[model samples]
Target: MVSKIIALSQGNREYVTDMRRYFHMHPESSLQEFETCKRIQKELTEMGVPFKVVNDIGVIAEIEGAKPGKTVALRGDIDALEITEKTGVPYASTVPGKMHACGHDAHTAMLLGAAKVLWAMKDEFEGTVRLIFQPAEELIAGAKIMIEAGCLEGVDNIFGIHVASAYKVGQVDCTPGPRMASADMMTITVNGVSGHGARPDQCIDAVVITAAIAMNLQTIVSREYSPLDPTVVTIGQMQAGTRANIIANKGTLELSIRSFSPEIRAGLIESIKRVATGTAQALRGTVEFKLTQGTPPTINHEGPTEIARAAAKEIFGEDCLVEREKQTGSEDFAYYSERIPGAMAFIGSAVPGPYVPHHNELFDIDENALPGGMALYVTYALKALAE
Candidate 1:
């Protein structure tokens, strides 16, 4: 079965690559993937696969096997980043200021290829394979929307893949447990009395208060949390005085927090509020703190992760499976894993030169990795359903 799956995937390589190039030439942003959704549906329709649209942009397709068994789902995000193309490939994005810099185009194509393969072999299996073509992943809102729309209603296990530029082609990382961090955005505003900057004690200084708040916020990670636990508190933007001679009456700070542990994530939010409020009040000012929750940490399930690992070993050989460090980046896929047994594999797609990170205009994946990803998708579905 594995050998047959490999051959099928290899045969579909050109189809997958062409589809990826087509998507690359016509990239779309989050939630606005209407045409991308339409293109996906058109491809599925051509394959004689049935599907339904959700949230106005997501595509859910199912392939049921010959016998009754548990249902497994395979997901691929179909949104592109807001970046201009710079790789200069012949299939470079035609849409100015928008490109598939995160390898989502490849993800979409691989899932489509897997769909075609599994659709042909439906009579040989004993379950269903649900293909989730999710949108708005860049905003980390697509998965929740898909779930609310019942994409995972009867799913027994779920699997996803992300292309990585860090490792060479043919390598894969299926490490279980806390593979990615949780992200949360925060804003802090400080209010103080306005006065002349030359005046020594006439009014409170919001700039000073804001600076103190930013400095104190860093201590939450250093002094409060364990050094071994990976965490980050970054003040990406700060706004203060309007004039150099006048003491500012209001100041604002924007922050991004990343952590792997839910307890630590919750604790960091409270600590940031505490520090900001304390620092503001100490300077005779008041603070207003606001938080916008993002995706939770992507912790892979042991059972599903083992299945993925075994499948990868069979598809790409034992040495192709390598362990990579935990990533501080966040992924919307966490929403699925949080509700059911799920795991996401990182497939190596590194090009020949220096490493270019995802979401950059110069980012791209080696097309040779597509067939392996497609095979992994088919093999994982079969193994999970047979379990």
Candidate 2:
């Protein structure tokens, strides 16, 4: 199956590479993947694969064989971040401040490469393979919308892959459990009274309350949680009074807290709420908290991890495989794995020299990782279909 996928893709090298660059040039974010969806749908249609396109940046294509067997799915995220591209590649993003820094460009290309290969081999296989192009992965809403749209209607097992810069080219990494962390976003609003800067007692300062809450929230991770457990809470952005002299009435804080364990995530959130409440009450101000939950850790099942490891061995040999530690960075792919047993692995693109990892203006991925990524995408699809 591996040799066959390579043979099929070898002839279309230019086509596949160009497709990735095309996506890189015109980047889209989250639920607004209109043009990206159109391009993917057009290509899938041209290949004669049966597919359904959802309204908000997602597409599911199914290739069914004559005989029925286990049904499996392959997912590729197709959204870009808000960062501007500074790589200056010929395909550098045309849009300002929005780039495909997260390797979704390679992801979409690899899946399309696999789709072309699988369409040719579908007749020889005995099951169905659904190729999913997910949107809003960066926004953390694409996977949920895809699930709600019934993309997982009859799937037995599913698998997804992320392009990693940590591993060098030609190597693929997998872990049996806890590959990524769950990210929960919190926004705290402190409302108070506004008055002249000179009149200290005339107004209640929202900035004072906001600063107290932020400082106290930091303690929740360092002092409150168990010393053995790992937790991280970062205040991404903070906004308050517009001018230096004005005592603003309201201040807002946007923060993200992440943890590897589900129990830890729950506890941290509860603690955040308690701290917010206590801090606001003490400051004689009111607080409003808006928290949104993102992806759960991409936990790979043991059985599926073993299968993926074996598949990796066949391509890069036994020594080429490695196990990566849990990453605090989150992926919406957790939604799919949460529904069924699956595995999500990382493929390396970290090449030598000054290269940005992801979401950086100078971020660049090693092109050598393309063939390996294409290989895994096709091999996983074939393996899942055969199982």
Q: Which number leads on lDDT?
A: 1
Predicted candidate 2 versus true structure: per-residue lDDT over 289-372, tens digit per residue: 898888877788886777677777766677878776687888888888888988988888886886556777787688767766
Cα lDDT, all candidates: 0.94, 0.84
lDDT of 1 by residue, 1-387 (tens): 999999999999999999999999999999999999999999999999999998668999999999988999999999998898999999999999999999999999999999999998999999899999999999999999899989999999899999999888889999989999999999998999999989938989999999999888878888999999999999999999999899999999999999998899999999899899988988999999889999999999999999999999999898888998898999999999989999999999999998899888899889999999999999999999999
Clash pairs (backbone) in predicted model 1 = none
| RMSD, every candidate, angstroms | 1.3, 2.8
Q: After best superposition, candidate 1 residue 141: deviation in angstroms?
A: 1.8
For model 1, the superposed segments whose C-alpha errors exceed 4 Å read: 198-200
